[model samples]
Target: MFSNEEMRDMVCVYSTENFNGRRAHRIYLEMYPNRRQPDFKIFKNLYDRLGETGSFHHKRDSAGRPKTLNSEQEEEILVRVAENPELSTRRISMETGVSKSTVWKTLNKEGLHPYHFTPVQNLLQTDFPARQDFAHFCRLQQNADPMFLNKVLFTDEATFTRRGVFNFRNKHAWDLENPHLVSERHFQHEFKIKVWCGLIDNYLLGPFELPPNLNGKLYLEFLQTQLPNYLDDLPL
Candidate 1:
């Protein structure tokens, strides 16, 4: 570690001598006759440092692996996460002084993982009673006949549009255990295709493509015509 004054003197001398290391060394020796002489390479090194960092002093060593966080830092991170399980690693790193990678490693070492949010339809309070009644009806039917559920056709529909679906990759809650996080999705107006599928008695039904603007008339027509074709093979 060369003194700032010595490094400054060497840089000045090196520049004044047309960047000739030998001449700069001789001039530096003359300037500091009583001071101990640095190695010949020191002049060139200091010159390069000044040019690169605009400083005579050495830059902090960054070549090796980054230093590990102390116990206190790790504790602070864990405590912050405990306080807010929803806190992301990036947010934790910003709040704390730890690097993002270090924060992630710390969380992982503590058995914490990021659980993505599941997207669900936005439901109204009124929908709860109907859902419960349906569930109760299904249970009663199953009690009456164990094969009732297998005989019933379970159907689902998905809408695809020019505007794609929501991406849930980045929506996550970080915790030691699965938080069972869910996000409600509201339907938006767009030109879309509605696809329908059904299942009954372990048999997969048609992945039928329904009309974009399916009204009661069109749906009834589908059931009267297209649906019968699919049901012909199955027992009534």
Candidate 2:
């Protein structure tokens, strides 16, 4: 590898005559006939990109499968991932002092795969007891009666909107060119509607539209008035 100082000297030599890359490269060849020089294409691209400092830039290794991680580094990266499954490839790269691509390759070679972070509603410590109680109740009911599910009513409320959110990491569009192209959405003016529904046995009921800023009174009214109408009209 040429030192940075040697690269500066080379740049000076190439730029002395204000010559184009091809002529400079020819001149360079004549000057150092015994030294192996980069291809004309590479030299041209470097000059076009870096100008007078082209030779100061290190040459990239385009040869097949250049090794970035040694056995020890590979093991260290694996251990880092094993300790923290949530560590992103970028984070792993920073921690292990390697490029993100190297970290990713190391993980894949060891049968590990990258995955996007999944979003979920956060539950507090207090919520766990309620969840456990609901699970226990369901288990007991299921144990007591084989047809327990048939007698139960399941209800939920949801919102519909003109806008939607998605994880770009989990989505892909394949095309001839760069397949990882991104799409931007504009939602300056938005509209949404809230709805409630219930299901029992073969009955799928009321996607009833709800008013804005629903409270206990509105919910109780819905349970008392709209829910009964749906239940009364249940299929025999």
Candidate 3:
């Protein structure tokens, strides 16, 4: 003795699960073992309607509870959000002629959630060809020798600083000579010392200090001198 809307809801679920209407009615009956099943003709009609519309939701009833945002308005909200992801919820509400809460619910249902911004390094125009060539070479090496990666010596240069971490409040000193709180800041410009290092298999190599005015020839000489010592120690 289910109401018309309740019967329609069951029919919708059935049609979605079992695409065939006749089979859906049998399963729907099995869903409620004790209760009397609805008429097959009515169930078939609802199933047909569901197939045509491809929607499980019941149609908006004029006499029933009023809808703040109709299907068309909800779709409009999705479109606006897609066009500009940075639009705020309030802005989306205004654009779609719906309330903020409605806009939020719509977006939530669509698996869209708010996220905070994060900073990352962007690729330069010159990097594209280099990246592609590196990838191609790696693929060729992978095909030629599976253990090629283990044989490679990865090297890079990084800087270490003598400056200790200090907040804005500590940077200022209460010296009466210069009440403006200015001090000789050597760490601001010349605190960093650059060093080069290499890694192979399980061994860590030298953190060799680079020359004060390092150039391409100096770098090549540095590598030529340092790499042989590390490579000789490698296991056969």
Residue-by-residue lDDT tens digits, candidate 3, 1-236: 24456556667756676656566667776776654454444455555545777643345333422237665456556655654678899887665557788788888987889876776779999999999999999989989999888777788897767654456744666665876754444655666677888887677777779986788999898878976876787673
Error in Å for residue 150 of model 3: 1.2
Winning model by lDDT: 1
User: Could you tell me every candidate's TM-score relative to the true structure?
Assistant: 0.55, 0.61, 0.45
Model 3 earns a TM-score of: 0.45
Q: Rate the local accuracy (lDDT) of all candidates.
A: 0.76, 0.67, 0.67
Q: In model 3, which regions exceed 4 Å deviation?
A: 1-74, 86-105, 114-131, 160-190, 206-208, 211-214, 234-236
Per-residue lDDT, model 1, residue 138, is: 97
Q: Candidate 1 lDDT, tens digit per residue, 1-236?
A: 35678668877888999988888878888988886565455677667767877876433333432338754456556656754778988787776656889998988988889887777999999999999999999999999999999988888878887656566855677899998886655547546789989898989897999998888999889888988888787765
